[model samples]
Target chain A: MKQIVFQHHPGNVSSIVRGILNRLVIISFLFGSLASISFAQAENEVLSIKSPWIREAPPGIPTLAAYMEITNITESPISIIGVSSSIAKMTELHEVKLENEVMKMRKMADITLNSGQTLELKAGGSHVMLMGVQESFKQGAEIEIIFELKDLPAVKVMVPVKKDS
Target chain B: MNSILLKTLTIILGLIALGFGFWLAINQQRNTGPLISEEVGIVYPQAREIGDFQLVDFDGQPIDQQRFKDKWWLVYFGFTFCPDACPMALNDMKKIKVLFDEKIAQQVDFAFISVDPARDTPDRLKQYVQYFDPDFLAATGEMSDLQELATRVGVVFVVPENPENQNYVVDHSTFMLLWNPQVNLQAIFKAPHKPEDVVKGVKKIIAAF
Candidate 1:
């Protein structure tokens, strides 16, 4: 009985290498696709509020000042037309301006936010005026504020009141 | 081979260098003038001089320019209804008062002037300041009289239309003016001011005097 010895062909060896390479590419593609999907979900779930801070008011006074950074990441620019909170009976956009050497705080109609830009509301500058507060704003308390944007969806932010700088 | 041309070029370059040196010196001097003095025990810009004014305190007592003579006074303007910045400033001033030495404390006084005269009556002013520091004095007068005093001290106070309405608020300056015994406005401290800075500034002024 004559038994033929098995012979390895160069073409078959090249084919095996090609198949392994194709498997690696597919695995890498799958990983990359999943990573991008998770990243997108994180961005979508991010809270809309930015840099929310509060300053203390006097005793027996129900008014307080709240400041924050409002950023627009959407494709089109948006405006923060107003703010509302159940804690305060009235919430308004207030801006501090210097006229004739006097610092005047006035109610602003709206705060404009350009796409990919940020609008900062700070002390002695632009701020959110919280009037007729239903309760005292205790330090370390989380307050929820609802922002109504011009064209985009309304955003809600939980801001913690701080006592120190 | 061209000695004359080379000399001319060198001279032109030297002149340009000299001009640049002069510009640099002037710019540095302007920028550093305020900070250098403050760091080296020099008087602050706000406390360099004093202004003249006449007004009444919360008790309707006459507090003319003379009230500042021979003593140091921390004077700020606000109303009883002020919600945020005013109270913060007052509380900071109270801390400064406590930081002073007994001797300096005797020589120093804290005064709060009412920019909203219509509502900040003598009683209201008294009650408001007493809440912060019982030793602190509160003052108020006619709107025009308050404006006159405010102008002298480089302060501004404006009443919004229908400010009497419970929903409306008045806007006023956040600066605290320092006055000497001569009742002259010597220095001004900007708002969001810290108590430490104020204490240091007051000690320097007292030492200088």
Candidate 2:
């Protein structure tokens, strides 16, 4: 009778250990999925920069403009606070408007992008002013243009220096 | 001795024949080289003289009214910072020069004067103007001085209301001013300018003169 009772007591301990192992596996699976869901959201692969280029001018010309298209793939809108480039002495957001039958340019502080909207910066319209170009931007060379956002980390875009078609 | 005298007479007769042939070529061109031009550029009823003004050349040399005398001047007022309009205009000016005869080409002077002197420097102008043509001249100087030249050239330029913004784009006219030997403004070629139109317009204007 003593041997039988010892086996019965061991059975209780084995059951408790098995229950703890099962709970741990369930906890691990839940945590893994939760981490992956947040990681995918944080990556924000929906936003993209496309076809960035600087307008070409004569070698000694000191100023030129850069153009690009920004696309917001996410369902929410993106807000742009500022832009910068190391290639130029300074950079400013500008827009060209027809005023009194003549084209005029003005500086813009910030821009807001709507959901699923692609903003185009082009000639005779919006552009990035690159002032005091020290180095000649060769036709095939690449330059980095950084966009400062309101919420996310700054993104650096590599734009090609090309002539206007 | 008789053979020597005959040779001298033959040489004199040959020289006279050559002179007569040259005279005939010159007379033929008067009738053949010129045709009555149907369409001419808008000519000012009175060619207004470009009054006394002070500005610097690409070399930073001071330019007075008298510096432009004794030549046909084609002056364009624009900034080097301009991407499309300015380069296209200057390039067309170069093409037009190529179409002219060497004598006619030598008589014309091409100049690019910047209204945006705050940003355009003489050193930059010196290098920038040559990109279009080696013979072209570029200049920029004090605002009042530039205005004196601009007004005489019939170009209008306006700066930004806020001068603190160093990156301001200037609003200026794009037409090229054509002037005569006396520094008088004669005609204006409006932009979206074509090289052929300029060449034809200049030829017609010269023929009228």
Candidate 3:
């Protein structure tokens, strides 16, 4: 039995090792496929908003500016048609134009976003203006702002009140 | 190179630290603050001296360049209705106050001049300024008075083109003008202003004067 085993061994042993390696490769490939599926789930979600913060000021401030970096991840473009917040009676899309030493805050009817583009609503620039705010937006407070996009469901974003440094 | 050499180096380092600590102690006792910001603009050789104009302060007292004299003044022009820029500037000034000692704080003054006299009444101005700091003074008067002071001070402001619009906007300069005790527009600290820079600028200005 030992002589027979030795005589039949070399090719079989090599093929067995090859088979184990192939099994391991197949297992890893299966996991890779699962990861790609999860990635696709994230890819399907188009609009990604980050660092949403409400610019806080002293108390009894009537208007609060909410800033965020908005990215449209999908192939299609997105535009912001309307904005609303429970804390304010009115919300408007506004942009600040600095020229001739004047910082001009102008209201916009609608703001558009291009595909694969990022919009930064930053301080001293564009912002979502919340006027007649009922709630105090002092530092460390969280406020919800609902952005109604064209042809999309209103996405609610929780913005933290970031005090001026 | 050897333990003896290492001991010498350590002792030298100890002496340097002791010297630094002594210098800091002397500085504290003398109340001589260091200038921190490098960007304090000294543009006052041809300083646009603010022309004569009288505006009613929040206390309903008349304020000309004469009133803000004999002390350092930091003036910014904006309205109470402003959302972002105005409040941010005022907050910056408040932080500038926190950078000084009590004696220097008394010497430094933050003034907000309103372009919209129609809206910012003494009562409204008082409420707006004291909301940031009780010591801050808010002033507004006739449009001509505001324009004359703004022009000579090299600050320009204009109302939004549409007169029919009730919710109008006033486009105003955001520079925080620093005035010496002589009330000459000594420096122009342009926005976006930082608390530390403003503090250092004020200290350097005071020290140099």
Best by lDDT: 3
Instruction: Give candidate 3's TM-score.
Output: 0.72
Q: Candidate 1 vs candidate 3: which has greater TM-score?
A: 3
Q: Assess the local accuracy of residue B108 in candidate 1 as a C-alpha lDDT between 0 and 100.
A: 93
**Scored by CA lDDT, what does every candidate get?**
0.73, 0.76, 0.79
- lDDT string for model 3 (B83-124, tens) is 788888998888888888787788889899999988678888
> Where is model 1 more than 4 Å wrong at Cα?
A1-47, A98-101, B1-70, B98-102, B121-131, B192-194
DockQ class, candidate 3: acceptable
The per-prediction i-RMS, to one decimal, reads: 2.8, 2.8, 2.0
Better of 1 and 2 by TM-score: 1
In angstroms, the error of model 2 at B32 is: 23
* Candidate 1 local lDDT, residue A25: 68
Where does candidate 2 stray beyond 4 Å? A1-51, A57-61, A69-77, A98-103, A115-120, A123-125, A150-155, A163-165, B1-48, B81-108, B159-169, B191-209
TM-score top scorer: 3
Query: A95-119 in candidate 3: lDDT tens per residue?
Result: 8888966788888877777887998
Residue B63 C-alpha lDDT in model 2: 84
lDDT of each residue in A78-155, candidate 2, tens digit only = 788888889788777887664532446677868878878988887556788788678888788888888888787677
